[model samples]
Target: MEEAAIGDAALFHSEQRLQQAARVNDTATIRELIWGKVNINARNSMNRTALHWAAMAGHERAASLLLDHHALVDAEDKFGMTPVLLAASHGNLSTLQTLAKAGATLTARNRLGQTLLHCAAVQGHPSVIRYVVEDLEGIPVDDPDQNGKTPLLLAAESGHSDVLSLLCELGCDLQAVDKESNSALHLATRRGHAELLSFLTSAICSDAQNQDGLAPLHLASQAGHLSCVRTLLDSQCQINALSSRRQSALHVAVERRQPPIVELLLRANINLHLQDQQGHTALDRAVRSQHAALADMIIKAERFHARSLGANGQTGELDLTLRHVGDLSRVRSVLWALATRHQKPGDWKKLALHWDFSAKHIQALENQWTGSDSYKEHGYRMLLIWLHGISSLGKHPIKELYEGLVEIGSTDLAEKVRRQANAEQEPARRCVLM
Candidate 1:
């Protein structure tokens, strides 16, 4: 029994070495192993024969030697990957030809239902892709895998523009989508392939949404792909296009802490008033995330747009793309400190009333409820919104801030704010609403 165990161990080591030899195309060791009467079709832990390794590595000489020794040509691995399928997947045209000539089925699919054409297209193997679709004749170029992703869709998912071009030339559907309804354009944007996204945008509509109702712009913004976002915007995609959750690209960008993307989107004519399903605007997201710079940016843009609208409801041509924040924005930290620390729970509403804020604006500011500390958040938002209105009218925020505090009967608080304002830098010194 011990001798039998020793023989079994010798054969196991020989098989492992045979697999290693086939992997590196060392045919001498393979010949020696074959002559020693080892099983040519011995499978490893993954049920992969030596032919799978040779074919996967494109070792044509090793593959042919094994086949000549009566190796199984159509042996299926754990993934149902045949030798021919592995050869095609690795872009081994010559090795694939050898397997095909050995009567290996070219149209065989893996467990995911991916054919030779699908595999070749995904790996950007143009020659193998053409050979499988044209020479095989039975496989369809638009054949979908288990996810309903055609070769073109897979090429897009893999970010292979050349493969996509070839697939398009071979009559693969440019408009093909995966099971999630993600088109080639959506997939390209999700992967942040700007060049591929640019090519795909021309062929597909940017308004197309996936199952999540997320447009390419939304994905681009959330992924922080600046070039992709620029490409989508330049392609005439909708700027304010909302998702299934009623969240715009701005909302996603803010929630995902994408400041540069938020800056870019703010340059466009986006609607700041658009709320998500949870009734949170992009400003709400920025505030909740405690990002003061991003919140101030959105406030500046929001105020600019609100002021630009005329009585006839036509928007003005004011360039809101100025990269720098103005004088009022510099006082944001002071305002936030006052709102969160100094002011009482109901003091912000009283200050808003003193500033003559309409019921609608007050209601919008008071919509969210985040426990007892929610009052502080509400106070900060109210201060920022008031600052927006004052800055838009070219009035001084510091002077108006003191007068509003005094009118709300916070006389000592108003004097302290005035002293703090005077202590600030030149930018805050420019606050002249006095």
Candidate 2:
């Protein structure tokens, strides 16, 4: 047993030396080993023969020497990688030709089911890619890896533009879906590969849905790839495109804290009221997630959009903020007076409900309290809510509220607000952000 163990160790050391020689292109050392009758098909622990190492190292002469001694041209290591596959991955064109001529299996795959084309694409080896896909009479360029990723998909996913371009020229199925049902375009957009994604623009319908039921636009937005998002949007992708869960790109953006993307979507007239599976609108999501600024921005955009649609019977380009800043200040002041004078329970609630403070928005504001005089706080919140709506309509919110007060017999507060607006200087600075 000891002698056998010793013998095995010696052979292992000898094989390591041969592999080392092949790795460094030491042909003379390889010749010496072969001359000593060393097994030409000797495999290392990974079952990678010296031929595999020589092919990977681009040692065409060493590979030829091993082939001359009857090395198994199709021998695969533990990774199921044939010598030809390694040669193709290294862009060893001459070695690949030699292996092909020797009847090496061009159709062989690794344990992951990745073929030479897949390997070449991943390595960005255009020459090897050409040789495998063009030279081989029946090459399987569209064969998928274990991940169901084709060579073209791998090239796109790897961002190998040259390899990807060649595959595109070769007419590989651009719309072929992977195991995850992710088309090359989906993978490209998900990876933020704008150039590669652009290359796949020839698909009849770019709205191919993946397993998650998200189109490329949704994935691009969710991934926060601004360029990809713009590209998809320009492709005539539905701005309010929803996922399987009914969450639009706006919802995904807010959930992921992508404020700039949210702004872009908002300007595109995305449906802010479009709720997701949680029954939460984008603004609701923003507030729930503590994105107060984002929530306010959405509120501003929604009101402005509604007013822009002329739903309120308003028209023309009135500057909502410039016209309403003084109005807002006076309304806040009047609310304090009304709360103090009326001293009525549920007045703030009536005002908030009357001015259209969303139940959710008013609830969020009410969560922050200081004593029993919370009506004053709710009324103030209501005034701010009214201000946001007024700004959106591009009208004077304070003036509208002032008129309502006069009709309700709050003539004293109404006159005070009118006097204040007349005393201001256009108030441009106060409403610049609005």
Per-model TM against the reference: 0.80, 0.73
Query: Ten residues in a row with the worst lDDT in model 2?
Result: 315-324
Q: In candidate 1, what are the lDDT values of residues 245-294, reduced to their tens digit?
A: 99999999998889889888887767888999999888888877777667
Off by over 4 Å in 1: 134-136, 211-214, 218-227, 240-266, 272-302, 310-345, 354-381, 384-396, 399-415, 423-434
Candidate 2 lDDT at 103 equals 89
Query: For model 1, how big is the CA root-mean-square deviation?
Result: 4.4
Candidate number of the best TM-score: 1
Worst 10 residues of 1 by lDDT: 316-325
Clashing pairs in 2: none
lDDT, each prediction: 0.84, 0.76
For 71-130, candidate 2 gives per-residue lDDT tens digits of 899998998999999998888999999999998988888998888899999889998888
